[model samples]
Structures are given as structure tokens and as C-alpha cells.
Target: MTGGLPLSGVRILDASHVLAGPFATYQLCLMGADAVRVERIGGDDFVRHHGGSAELRTQGMGGSFAAQNAGKACILLDLKAPGGRDVFLKLAAACDVVMENYRPGVMDRLGVGYADVKAMKPDIVYCSLTGYGPQGPFADAPAYDHIVQGVSGLMSMTGTKDSGPQRMGLPITDYIAGLTAALAVAGALHQKRATGEGQHLVVPMLASVLAFMGSYAIDAQTLGRERGLQGNAPFSGSPFAGRFDTVDGHLVVTANTAAQAVRMVRALGLADLEPLAAGTAPDALSEADRARVAEALDRTFRTRTALEWEEALGAAAVPAGKVRGLGEILAHPQTAAMGCLDDLPLPGLEDPVKLPGLGFTSDAWTRRPLSEPEAPGQSTRDVLAGLGLSRREIDDLARAGAVAGPGLPPRSA
Candidate 1:
């Protein structure tokens, strides 16, 4: 993976845990960076024990943790301890990037904050992912994905009016923040390479959500558009841009342009609505007319299966698709064509775990095959040994509750 990617040979110390910070470092790993996750001594990432079923969590390969931490090495150091902090600073001096997702003052109190790290590594890109920025009224308040979702108005914009505000099923904000952090870190790395200067980055989930919702807020301010739940409908209220039920399942048909509307109406056997399809703004239709057309379309769509409608609409070049579940998506032919999923071996699991790889691909570079996710402290001894710690010193640190490694007793507080 390190062969020809843009971030090849970049060394990163990933002191982040759970989703957001870990995912940022994971992105760097995909770009061929030598990213190592430094776990707390004697502790695993909360995600490792929080998600998935009891069976999976007991195996210590909770689905979420495995997905986010794939392709990274794990080492443990009790940074509160003097010996451990020294080892961390040593690693910082040798690495290009140091990343964490601790709260604002936690890192400073731990004595491994950016200022502390910068003194040891003059050209280090230090990135922090926090719930809110370093200084804000809510900065000190603890935040997670769902809390930010509600605070950012994202929850208000989801679901239908009847269901009220509904949270998105996944940790969307966390993933978005992680992706943004990765991009920011990459830019900082590029600048450092060119000018020999490092950077301190503070990425906040609140800021990331606002950025993601920028267009929405701008539209409200500039166009007097009110934010409201529209369910499966497009915000524009385009009649064609909604879901309709078929015999078996739902089909999403989006015909935004005049030509697309024409094709869609013609395909659905609703020629009477052809004029409306031909550049007629949805609001131009009377309520009666809109209701009549929706009724007709719904009746017609129910005559066939979702797949049947999808194929028919596709043939007419009107954008359409059947709403699919995860199982269907995994079985779909397009999923195979995308080549975005891989099966990696995991310890104690009988079957190789299938997981999504990079969201995109490049002709110029290829991601290396994924290695299984590592257990906490899985590579501690090797990492310390690489840092010039002798076997006796490494063993001493383990014995003194300052460090942990594979097969060694977890350090006690």
C-alpha cells in the first residue's frame, strides 16, 4: 500500500480512539501512511466493546471497531506515567503527524498536548478532533454524534413531519468529521513538505456539521426557504423527485429536468401529465392536479415490482432505482463491479470479515490489501523495540504498570 500513494512513508501516531479520530488515521493508512494506533494501557477503545452482538463483542472484534481500525497497528502506553510519556515524546519526535480526539483540556492536562509535542518534534502536524472547537461555550460540554446531530439542526431536517425529528441511523457526523480531518491533515502535510513548517489543526464536529449543512442554511437565508421535514421528497418539492411504492418494494424516481420528466411521464403511461413534466414547476400545478397525478402514478407503480419499474425507467433514461436493503446491496451486481469491499482475516473468526474499503479509487495508485484489525496493545513490544527500548526496559515498563504489550499483563492504574 505504501508503494506510490501520495502519503507514502508518512509516519503517524494515532492516539485517537473510537470512530472519528480513528477513522481519520485510517484514511491516512489507506493512503499508505505508516499509521499506528496508541491505545491506553490496559484499556481498549470503547467501540470495541460497545457495538455488535454479545458474541462478536466477546471476541473483541465489534463490527464498528474492526471497520474503523482496520489496517492499523495498536500499541499501549500509559501516558500519565513518566516513562510512558517519555516513550510517547520519543515517538512524536520521529513521526510526521500526531492525532487525538480528546476533549480540549484533556491533552494539555495529560502533558502531551500540541505545545508539548511541538517542543520535541519541531515539524509535526498535530491534529485534534473535538466535539466542539478548542474555545466555545459548548466546547467543555461532552458531545457525541447524536448530540451534535440534534444541536446542528440535522435531526430537524430528517424524516417526515409526522415522525418529528429523527436521527439518521448511522454516526454520520463522526464519519464526516473524520473525513474532513483527514483532508485537513493531508493539506498540512503537503504544506510542511514544501515549507518545512508544521501546523496545529482543531477539527470540531459542530463545525463539520455546519459545513455539511452550508447550502441548506444559505438557501434558507437567501431564498426564504424554511427548513422542514419532507421525508423521501427532494427539498425542491419536485413531484418527480420522490419515492413510490411498487408491487414488491419502493422505487425512487428522480426526474428533475424537462426532458427527464417527459421521459418519466411517458414511461409511466401518464401522458396527460406530460406538459407538467415538460418544465412545469411543481408549484405551478393546482393542488387538485398534483394530487390526481400522484394518485395515477402510485396506481401505475403498484402494478409492477420495484425492479420492473427500475428496469423500465432505466431503459427510458429516466433516473430510477429500487430502494434496497443492505442485503440486496451486497448481492447487487454493481456492488461486485465497484470493487470497494474486501475480505480480511480476523483472529478467532471462522470466516474472513468483509468490509468496505476506500470510498473511491485512483488510476495512479492502489490501496494495499487490508490486514486484519489489531487488538489493543497488539504490537506494543514491537513498537517499543523499534523505538530502541531494550527487552529489559520494555519488560520493566510492563511490570511497572506504565505500558502493555501482547501476552503481557495489562498495566494497572
Candidate 2:
């Protein structure tokens, strides 16, 4: 491990699951924070078998679980049980941060809510992430990424005008919530350092998604204009910006600037089809003119392969690249040069698994060597031992189903 990761020495007790909560803690874990994921005794994270192939579920290493949960330890404590709640309080008292992402009041009902944990550790940074917020009409509604996307107006603004509303291909809302929550946690930690006071942070998926749609929301309110999908068109409303088909495949090209637009038409040998704007002017072509230009460009782009167009457009300084799928992009030379994708081992897998890397770069943060993703509760005994629990006590708890790990009772069906 490289020295001086930003979150080094910080301890976080993460009692959350699914995507957003786990991902937020995962970020800290990657930065050398001691992120301990606490789950119910004899239970597994729903995501452990949520997606991916049947083989992954059998191996207890689902791709969805491994994708976001690297570099964290797992512990099992039945928080619903009195003994389990006691164990959790003990852990919270020793940790710097505690986080959970249940519906409003779920944690409080569990008796391990923010106030309860803060009582044990006055300066603990606590974050409660939820779908909406603690107090709102929709607060009690169950929400997932897609539901939030639709509610937040993201889906209404995506896709083509012809396709109607469409959900994004990925769980964008969950990730946005996770990233926002991580940022808030970091900021609260910083403030705590100066004031010697902990913070209670509320990270709402609806709020995060709205933040992502800030510009659109502002436009709707201020200009009385609601933006609609334009199907691969750039949000800037530039007619010169969209995906095009090459002789062999497709490519995405954006000539948003006037100069680039001129260069693009000229590059395609369509000098006669000069744009109405020039030299930093905004795209103002009428519908008919835009259609004519697009038709001509389409014919021209079809004259060359995607790679050829990519090179030619790149040489002319127009922003463009060949359209690529997930597999192709992951295996691309650029990804390899950045050291962003790695094949690491997963639990019950004989071979290394390929996964994406961190989003940001830091000279002081080197990813530690990869270890197989641990099964839920795999470290329960060791974690309890670190809390100074005697072997007899640990055994007693396990036998009573208050704590579970390798030798514990089978989960109720």
C-alpha cells in the first residue's frame, strides 16, 4: 500500500446495502479507510445474488456485488437482537463514522439510529442516506434508480423525441447518490476536525438527481421551456453535434463550435454546404437547413470507416471517436495505459475477475494488492475478537444466532 491515502486511519461502520450505501463506503475503503460493512447475522446482502449469472450466485461472488465492494471487510451482527444491538453499539463507539441507507425511521426503529449512535460517540460523523429525505410526502415511498430517474425528470429528458421517455442504461441515480454522499461525508469529516463536533448528514437520491438536472430544472422554471430529448444530439442544441454512421460502424462527433462546424463540413468535402454560422457563432440553422446538412454529412461519413473518420476528424481537431461498447472500451488501449481496469480474484472463482478502477487519481494512493471478495460475515469472529470479546462469548453469540460467520447456523429459509 502506498502511504498517506486521504482517508487513512478513518474507521467507518457501514450498515447499508444495495448500491448507494455500499458504494459510498467502498470509496472510503479504496482510500485506505477501515470500512467495515455490517450485515444481519445469517443473512447476505441482497446484491450478492441480485444480478449476474447463476454461477456467480452459487459462488457467492456476484458481479454486481464485487463491482462495488472491494477493499472492505464484512461483519455479521443481528442488529434486531438485543445482543446484536449491544455489539453494534460497541463497534460504533470505536469508529469515527457510521452510515446507513434505509427508509426514514428504519434505523431509529432498529434502535441504532444516528441519535443513539451519537450518544455513544459524541464526535462520530453519521450519514443517513435515503430515497427521498427524512421529511417529505415521498419519503416513505420505495425508490430505486429507475424510479428516481423518472421522478427526477432525468428519463423525460433522455433518449430521442421519437422514443418518448427512456431510462438510462445504467443505475445512474444510485451512483450519483453514492458519490454525493461520499463527498458530504468527507466534508463533514473536515468540519469535525476543526470544530470537534460530529455531523448528521442526509444524502437523498432525489436531491442528488435534481442536482444533476440543475440546468434543465432552471430552464423550465426561468424560461418556461422544457427540454426534450433530441436523440444523440448534444444538449447545447448544436445541429453539428450527433452520432453518425461510418462505412463500417458508427462514431460520435461533436462540432459544437463554429470553427469546428466549418472544419467538419470542409473535411467531409461538402464545402458548398457551408453552415449559416461561422467563427465561434452559436448553431442557428433552421430545421430544413439542418436536415439538408445532416443528409449531406451522412452521405459523406458513410464514405469512410469509423476508424478512418476518427483519425481524419481528430487530425482536423474536431471532437470525435468511434462508438464503442462496454467490452471494447474496457479493453481499449487508453484504459490500459491509465491502469484503470484490472483482473482480480473473486470468492470461489478460480481465475482473476476483470473490474473497473477508481474514478480519480492520487499520487499518494496506490491500490493495494487485490484479494478475493470476502463472503458476508467472513470476518465476524476476527472483528469481534478485536473488540476484546472472549472466545467463549463469541461462541455463545454465534450459537444463539446473535452473531454469525463461517461456523454459524444456517440462514433461515
User: Candidate 1 on 16-104: residue-level lDDT in tens?
Assistant: 88899988998888888988888886675778876666776877778888887887778888987758888888888889999999899
CA lDDT, every model vs. true structure: 0.85, 0.82
TM-score of each: 0.95, 0.94
Report the lDDT of model 1 for residue 92: 88
Error in Å for residue 352 of model 1: 2.0
Backbone clashes under 3 angstroms, per model: 0, 0
Q: Clashes in model 2: which pairs?
A: none
lDDT score, candidate 2, position 205: 96
Clashes of 1: 0
Q: What is the lDDT of residue 328 in candidate 2?
A: 88
Q: Pick the candidate with the highest TM-score.
A: 1
Off by over 4 Å in 2: 42-44, 275-283, 348-350, 409-413
